[model samples]
Target: MLRHFAHPKRLTLVAVPLAVLVAVAVTPQVRGQQGAGAFESSDEVRAAIARAERASKRADRRAQSLERAAGQAEQEAEKIASQSAALAARIQETEAEIAVGKGQLQLIARQQRALDARLGERREPLIRLTGALQNFSRRPLVLSVFRPGSIRESMYLRAVLETTIPQVRGRTAALRAEIDKSRALRAEAEGVLRKLAEEEDRLSLRRTQLAAIETRKRLAARRRGGEADRQEERALAYAEQARDLDGLVDRIDAAGALRDELAELPGPILRPTRPSQARASGTTTRIPPSTSRTVRSPSGLRLPVDGRTLRGFGSVDSKGARSEGLLIRAGAGAQVVTPAPGRVAFSGPFRGYDRIVIIEHPNGWTSLITGLARSDVNVGDTLAEGAPLGVAPPDGGAIGFELRLGGRSANPLDHLSR
Candidate 1:
């Protein structure tokens, strides 16, 4: 009897120190690993391999995401480069056009200078005519062909004054108008050239920005790739761990096979029950209707929190049994309440459970309330559905409510009336 009882105590004693030692040893190696369990099932070991596997998986995912981003960036860079080339071509064309405009301006300036000289010559004629006209106004030209020299000179001068001065003035005005139009055209061409240069500069700047983006994308891809490789490794490690665990369990089963022999030979004997018999005798199998009132619903479940349901209850793709409960992510410090009327049978921490409450209803059904910040009700306390049990804190994780019938998991939503 002592040996049988003492084994568990001895194992506990050894296991506690062994776990502490392993923790101290593996702390540095597993510093960044997030989700792996602390110790192997049978005994504590440095299991840095688990950490490596987690790192590998994280790295792999990041690498994949980065690779996708990098590819997109590369495509964008190429597009920007092409646009930059086109802008460069346009700039070159504008430069050539500007050169041609300058040459035309020079030619136009020379023509304007020639026109100004002609106007000066015309001005002198007009001034002389004005003086002659004043003198002629006082005297008459002789009508006869053989007249006095002054009279004949006056007649010829009168003809030249009417025709030549008016012609010169009209020509000068036309030339001035043409010069003004040419000046406007030259200014417009310069403005267009300036605009084209500005556009080219913008494209050049865009190309530079795109290049930088490409660099960042490539770096991200590299990091992600590393992560991906790591994840693959982790998955492999988990497979190995699972295999090792199976082997260990098999060995334990074999070692414990001699339970009958041990019982016969020893002082205080404890007969080992078969797996099926042990399971049948387990007290948790079911609570009778007379003893428990909290029962599961027939169907139609509702969410506890106001937020949209993220996942359904029985997702076939799930690796394990579909979640037996509803997960409600409520606001921080939100009130947690009971979903049905029942007596609180169990309250406090259970294995793998945080603050918890178990309600036994009239129909022999039980509802498990888990992930509570505080459990207000104690064993034998009765609670009605929707009664405030406690306040849930943020990061309290989603409140989980599960229904069980005769100790078998059931969908809680099937029982909820609301």
Candidate 2:
């Protein structure tokens, strides 16, 4: 076995391209796993990530297959075009041959017409010679010896017969040759016409196949364009909503008068319209809620993060300050989803917390989630359970959450299904 060796510069170039390909291949999978908090367990999140990776790989393979088919179609189109060009040239050549044949036929017709004219002019002379021969035959041989004019005329008639015999044979042969040439010209023209028709049919079939390929390409391009547009619209909407919430939260912090106003909210909460569907009969239909394991789960709460719980409720921090919530370490830039269906009460940058989001739920339950890079929801916006709320920060950062009932803090874990 021979050891393989490569130049350093060549290796670098090849390696860089391969690395980029690997990264591009994994991008879709990572994007698919953005909202990590939506899953109840870390195992489920991992499974989803793995599934997304496999799907992306499958999509890449399918894309490669399509590219191959497109290449093949292009090659076939080029080949057909070449064949059509050749056939067109051949057809032109055949037409030229047919034209030459037609010209030859016209020449032959002219020659035949001239020969017929000459034969017609000789018709009267031949008739006169016929009568003279007949009269000469009717008299006896001895009678011609006694008649000098008859013998001289008979000698002149014999001399005319000797020359005319060869001329007639030559004219008949020339007329027959002209007729044969005409027949050959007609046969050649017919053959060229038949071949041209066949080539035209082949050309039509190739054009149809090329048209079908073009149609599929156009349809696929339109579908991809529509998907890209939808994704862009969603991103823009999210960004705008985040900006509004940040402004609102800032106003509430500066005022210090919104607390009393926030406490005076109505008791009844409006149900979220999300996950609702419309029936074909013009009626609204609601999808069934997920099954809950906790029978006495007053808040119907779910854990918002999957990291290790660092501190419990009512715990003392390093600053000797009693914490009103739980502190948990989560993945960097991981997605934060709403724990339960509720309306957004507050979302903005807090004094100590980088960013915070508060959701007001039914039954006097309110959740305060803090330490986000940015929030995705706005105050007064109703959210479905497990909907995206914000993005968690990176650098081994921890998130803080508080579950408050009425005015007192409650243990968030106590109401969780798991």
How does each model score on TM-score? 0.29, 0.32
Query: Which of the numbered candidates is closest to the native, going by highest lDDT?
Result: 2
Runs of candidate 2 with Cα error greater than 4 angstroms are 1-299
Model 2 lDDT tens row, 52-148: 3443343334334434444555555443333322222222223223333333333333443444455455445434544554554456545667876
Q: Model 2: clashing residue pairs?
A: none
Evaluate model 2: give its lDDT. 0.51
Candidate No. with top TM-score: 2
State residue 227's C-alpha deviation in candidate 2, in Å: 31
lDDT of 1 at 304: 34
The number of clashing residue pairs in each candidate reads 21, 0
Q: Rate the local accuracy (lDDT) of all candidates.
A: 0.45, 0.51
Model 1 Cα lDDT, one tens digit per residue, 1-418: 2243233433333333333333322322211121123232212212232332343343334334434444555565444333322322222233223333333333434443454455455445434544554454445333433665855565565445445544544544554454455445446545544654664565456445434543553454456546544533433343344343223223222222232235335255356566455443444423232324344363323333332234456654357756755676543444455555565555665445567666655445556767777765545444433333454665435777666655566676565564
Instruction: Report how far off residue 249 is in candidate 2 (Å).
Output: 12
